[model samples]
Target: MLYSKQKVAKAVLVLIFFTVVLIGITLVSLNNGRNGTRSLRSFVSEDTSTSPESIDEALQYFIYGAKYLLAAVKSTVSDNSANITAVSHSITVVKDRMQMLLSEFEHHLHRTEILSFLSLPVINNHNFSYIYNREDICSKKAVKLVFVVPSAPGNVEKRQTVRKGSRGDYVRKNANNTILLFFLGKPSPGSNYLSLQTKIDEEVKEFGDIIQADFEDVYSNNRLKSVSMLRWISTYCSTAKFVIRADDDVNITTVEVVSALERAAETLSNFIIGHKLIADRPSRNVKNKYYLSKKEYPPPTFPPYLLGGLLVYPVSTAKLLYQAALRVKPIWLEDVYITGICATKVYIPILSDPGVVFQHRKS
Candidate 1:
């Protein structure tokens, strides 16, 4: 077969064009491959129960991996100035996209993780903290404000002394100074609460300038119980910078709580009083928890609600958190519901300060 030089040249050009096209497609495929692997690792790593703290840790890991991967791509493009520089540059572009996607995922994981830990811990009968070290992290700093969560026991047999004060209100701590709130909930019979309510009434009368509310029947669902309480608190602290939210039954010396709250003024509000909650195997069906119901919440796990009784949230943070809590469906996990579902949404940091112990086990 005899072919002209021109014809041979034309055939060669066509062949070269097809070859380049094939190479381009292959490189694109390789870039997509890198992205797929990174995406899988970034979003779907493993199946395990994630606590808020663990979620934060995972975000850190994702961030670190992303940065490392990007650096590797950059180095490949910069250092390898060889025949494959074009391919390397393409690879780097793909790598950057993967990192960006992963970072977004990291943020999402953090949000969910925080909510996972928010179900309010039931600290009614048993104690979560033993002999607590009172002033560990929150020693005397400046003593900004001491906030109290007013707990009303249904039967107030033992609450005679607390009830006999000037105002006969739920917030009978010290009205003359500092801040106070009537965190209304189901009252218990053991604390002589009827009389205590009387005392609280008097206390309110004396220093009525205190911060307080009476949500005695707000929490029929645990999902919004802590949130309801927090909203109750935030309404009072409109001007105050810092706040301390604590339980009535739990033993916390006013002087001590106030001192600690001052130190934490600079730290994040929307903080929960933390103790190692003795987590028994909760009912496999999230609905098994009394606070949880399938109608409002169909999910199997509770939102990260802190124990409803005690916590400290800054006024501004509390407002944002309460709004977020309203947005989420009720999950019946009281504490986690507030911290993870509500507070976590704003990217507000939730912290546990020393001296502000939880589960102190006392009546």
Candidate 2:
């Protein structure tokens, strides 16, 4: 008879529990026997004048207790062996069923051509007209790093000044190997935001390193921003060895980031490095800004994700993650959607490091 997956899973858990209990019991019993034997030897040695009958009685008691304990353990082992066999069979059935289901899912995805978005049309407002397109670095010379900074439209001048004052020297020193691009979205329509837009346009023309995608600049649209950034990177700056996605407020020097990247260069491919959040649950309070409704995400716990404020990935990993994002349904939480769910699909390893701090600091 076929067993349901739930039943099979329960049986496997039972088998594991029994195995642990059996091992624990065996260890405890062995320790007790050793202590008992030591005590008996000590008693005999200390009481040299003790009668043989007394010693024999004590030995008999010990042996009898040991025999009873051993018999009980043997019975348990026998019963557990039968249970383990049955549980193993159930596990095998479950594994087969899971494999069949996975195959069917893959077939369905292929039939729907869900993974065939290699030629996705560039979103309307995604054209990088005034980009600081460094053709020289994009060619035969290897670009070592690319910094993708997500910035608010209003913070253009402040961010630019901070970048120049703090990280300008480092950028110039590694001019051949490093590039930094600030990503932004259009300000909300109908607001008195034309001045902010004009300022952003002026900066873009002056610096030529800002990428403004077609999307609303809001907290809820960060996931879309992240996806748009990744798609842009995959298309234009795919040759860079490492990519660091960070926020404008983060106070990290280019030197420090490049030093870390250089240290991990040998084994960086398909690896994401950042502070990791493990087993984080969705906030339930409706009033909380981060609250996720049951309809938005039904899972009790989220998969491990890197903090959104700062993340480092090998260029190849960035490409794969972007492709994965195209296939996975996006969640509003950019970090969870792009780095957690999409990264999991591609089996990219997310490594936690304390070096990348996300907290805001004055430059």
Candidate 3:
């Protein structure tokens, strides 16, 4: 947040007002001592008639008042100097904070230009290959929409939950127009790898909806999973009018998504929509889970991005974004790298459809 100019001005004015009040009190006290009166009111009300002795006493009072006035002025000046020094320090702190905010704002405002100029990782078609693919799923069927979910090999229960929920029901009801498939990579090699792969093979045999690629399915390789999905869709499901990239944990209202797409059939190509995050600054704290080092992304703020939980875009846009990703370096954050950086490269706008996507919470 920017430091408020009005607040600073008001504070300075208040300090000055208090300084003047202190000076007035000092002068009043000096006057009361000179007249030997309890208060200024009593001194003013005393008799003015004077003899020669009284005149001499009045002259003495003037000399004392002058001396006391000078002393009081000096003390007030000293106090005010200290106050001015404190105010200067405060202003310096506020200035530094404001500069940081402005610097971040500048990065956000011009992110597209910066992303375009930065060097990115380049790759060829062989960067990823499919270990298990079902090209026949889209080749034989006239698919209007496809839902590609990136799943970890160990998340067998989550996959089953999706198959049992509305997503499964929607595909079952409209198999001709819709296709739902889970995208996965090899699980981390461990003692349980064989057991997990065996179960995955069984699920593939039973469901015929899982697509496995030749990459390690670790947290850092999430971007690889998404890029693989894009390449698969563009290669096999190009006829699909719309594609929804969803996380395994999200609960999608497939009915609403279909209805919305049907209503916008005339303008469904080369566009994307989902939950959008705008002008989000990259986390710099090393302890943060989403931290981005300056060496990785020098910019203070990331480009506008859609959340990875749910995203809806035309297959045409997905193809363009995939092409863009081939040249752009992948970031640690998959959502920011794919939807934010790659989408920006291709000039696709990331919008919001709150009613269509919801984060699923176990009740």
Candidate 4:
């Protein structure tokens, strides 16, 4: 079946046109997968007036594009004979852009809502030096107990006195198994306070067990101080088995704390052990120092929380509580906010222990 030359030429031209169209469609699909459906609009709206709805729509498109690109990159990387270097470069660029977009979205949400807690920046310039930072404390031995003592700036002398009088034997006995750190805030700023600063410096030089952050030394900032201390532990002493968040003034029986941790070591990975308060209502009296406004806490009954003066928890529980605190608004009561609310947010259990008593005692 021989055909004329002109007819054969016409058929070849038609085939070429169809092939071009198919290639064009393939390119468009790939571009869409990389930049989403609103890719064109995103570029156009860059210089044009846009509304919130339009920005939201663009965000959705960008998210879709990111997901699609991620899948494509993963698939491409799995192929053994693919151009690995080129694919990796492309993926890095896409990841940077996606991260930038997500950051912008978070900023927008912060502006529109009361999410100040979520925006709390990481504590910077924790001014206190590491007086007794044993980086290998957990690595070298089994750390059964870690006592985090929250102390005031004015209580340095008292702390030293107590350490020498009452805690000396306990410290000596648990030298390898326990760690003790005094948490403090920055000193008051004034010329008259120079002597106090010098005293603190001398004490730190002698003991080297204080952890000071840049926050104010006040009752209301206790929650912040607690969280900051947890952050420090998470950064520096993450391998410890258990922790006791306590006050410098509290009479902590180190023997009791070590025994409890030893007994519960197998079953207590995410539990808080302390004197628990159940079904306690928030105070409403304006004259009371522990007053709670409805705006601050609308819940009728407070979740069961350990007494702030002395609470024991596994290191894992402390880490989870710290993470949840970063996302939740802090209440004035550090015990309720951190152990009850934040722990609840992260699904950590709070258990009552009769041994951890909170009372002032005369040495």
Candidate 5:
């Protein structure tokens, strides 16, 4: 007998939940066990013959948890009036360590690379030895896929409803008609906040594929964002002609973005609309996480920055941007400094729509 599609999806959700839980327990047990803070014998009664599938599942969960934990640490580390020098230095050390772990766990799965061939990538002129996949990067015109990283199955499904079938792929009436808002990654389990994130991610699935993708690193959270982003750019850009990148917190009208982008699809190199700022402060300073040393960027105002909250770039631009980001030093704030710098260096202008973009800076 064949099961209904709903049943199948539900079963998959259950499997994932248990898998994430067991993995979390096991990793916690092992580490705590070694330190003698907690005993591991009690939790080791389960089957030891773990298969590649099980290990892979566990590792992914470990990585997801680490990402959340890292965000938690960075967000909570410094006090309100902390000195920029000391806080900045501490953050730098943590960022360096996180980048190391992220570097170590590079390829858990071929992610963003899955859909890269759409637009013709503009050549990168950075100081580092950057390799451009001329043949595959941004060669395609359009493609379809779901974004699964931001939440759980049920939540992802809801987001898909908002994103999918709403305005139909591309917003404006134009040729190159497909643009998908793909959301991916894992959400923390059994938490009210994560539950909300999962719900939002499900809604995003309607827009594309929300695969249960994760990077396999338990020690560092930066590794997950860094790793997941690398995966997304590598695999996803190949199929999309133009792409939209966003965080779950912000409000995004994909249809409006498509309409706005389509208007300038002919003249623009790349577009990133939203309130953009290039922070002049130092990121290492615990007081201000959105820090960039004045020496690195001397001007009081940002050098044509974009609000990392929402962005729309040609697939080629995404590929080029990610590649350029990899070669540069990883900063504390991932989206702004890394993406803004990469885009600015290569002259990939962050397109903006003043009407839609909103930014509130810390005074």
Candidate 6:
């Protein structure tokens, strides 16, 4: 179980900590001669007289040395705090690689148990004809942002709310440079699909911001929705400097996203930033909507992924992810498949940005 692994990891970390402490003390001792202090070797060698004062002096020297050693370690740790953080980040990257390898092995081992679970028929074909696409939105000028929102066809009210909100208004006013498009698939079978499609057509005609694809709008096809968005961006919005994949229910400020992008403009290559989810395991409870059977996903923990609520990356990163998505086995969990698996495949570095806010709408 994961608990045993955590216990072993903690033990290793403790061992490493003690090893560092010993090394610090050794370096401090070796530098005593250069710093005009009595070395421990000299203190022992010179003080050979069997007087009680000599013994007391030796004891006091050792006490002083202990204090000095502690101070050196503390100073070293403090001075190199940034380096320590980088080391921790490197460890996290290594952990992600290990988990990815484990997941791959498990997938191969149980390939036959699942029924076309990872197949990407929609992605491979690349025949995503837009029922209502704003292909000309970014045609005339350079686009600064392409905000992609994936929504269900039934959530018409949600779409309108987002449009009337501040974020949508920002996109609407900056239509020449910024764009917001809703990506959707065909309506579900239980709903009035034709009627809903009619309403969507009307909405798109009025607002010119919908990109309906040629697939079913079901929970299992969530990854396909992302694939479609990427494909669209690659085909039509390649000039965009940045792209965001957010959910319809999530409230995100466009101005804040633009500001974050501004701060990260210098190092935009191979970059993806979002709220990170590390060591999250799939739910096993059947009653839970996010449940996954052992046969579907054999790993104990998922690879680190960004939450599906909001994701920000450059257009170049999106292209790389789309290319990787075609080869990597698809998963129903869109966030894990795109941000975790595909991003890892292409060696795109995902930065954890705590400032990306997500306020989910109530049901």
Clash totals for all models, in order?
60, 1, 0, 2, 59, 0
Candidate 5 or 2, higher TM-score: 2
Stretches off by above 4 angstroms in model 6 are: 1-123
lDDT of 4 by residue, 1-363 (tens): 112335434533443343234323333344445533544334334533643354445445445545565565555545454344435555444444333333333333233232344356643333444433445545776666677888877787667755764344565675547767788776667774667667777777887777767666788878877887777677777877778776777676766765665545443335677888899999999998999898999999899888888888777667766766767776788889988898776556666544666666554
Compared with the true structure, what per-residue lDDT tens digits does model 2 show for residues 10-79?
Answer: 5334533443344344434444564334443343344446433532343343344334544544444444
lDDT of 1: 0.46
Clashing pairs in 6: none
Ranking by TM-score: 6, 3, 2, 4, 1, 5
Task: Please report the TM-score between candidate 3 and the true structure.
Answer: 0.65
lDDT of each: 0.46, 0.63, 0.69, 0.63, 0.44, 0.68
Model 5 spans > 4 angstroms off: 1-161, 164-182, 187-208, 216-237, 278-280, 283-303, 355-363
Clashing pairs in 3: none
TM-score result, candidate 6: 0.66
Candidate 5, residues 166-235, lDDT tens digits: the string is 3334433346454333333344455555665555444444333343344322222332453354456556
Better of 4 and 6 by TM-score: 6
> Lowest lDDT 10-mer window, candidate 2?
103-112
Where is the poorest 10-residue window by lDDT in model 1? Answer: 125-134
Q: For every model shown, what is its TM-score relative to the native structure?
A: 0.45, 0.62, 0.65, 0.60, 0.43, 0.66
Instruction: Provide the lDDT at 51 for model 3.
Output: 27
Alpha carbon deviation, residue 103, candidate 3 (Å): 28
N/CA/C clash count, model 6: 0
By lDDT, the best candidate is 3
User: How well does candidate 4 score on lDDT at residue 294?
Assistant: 88
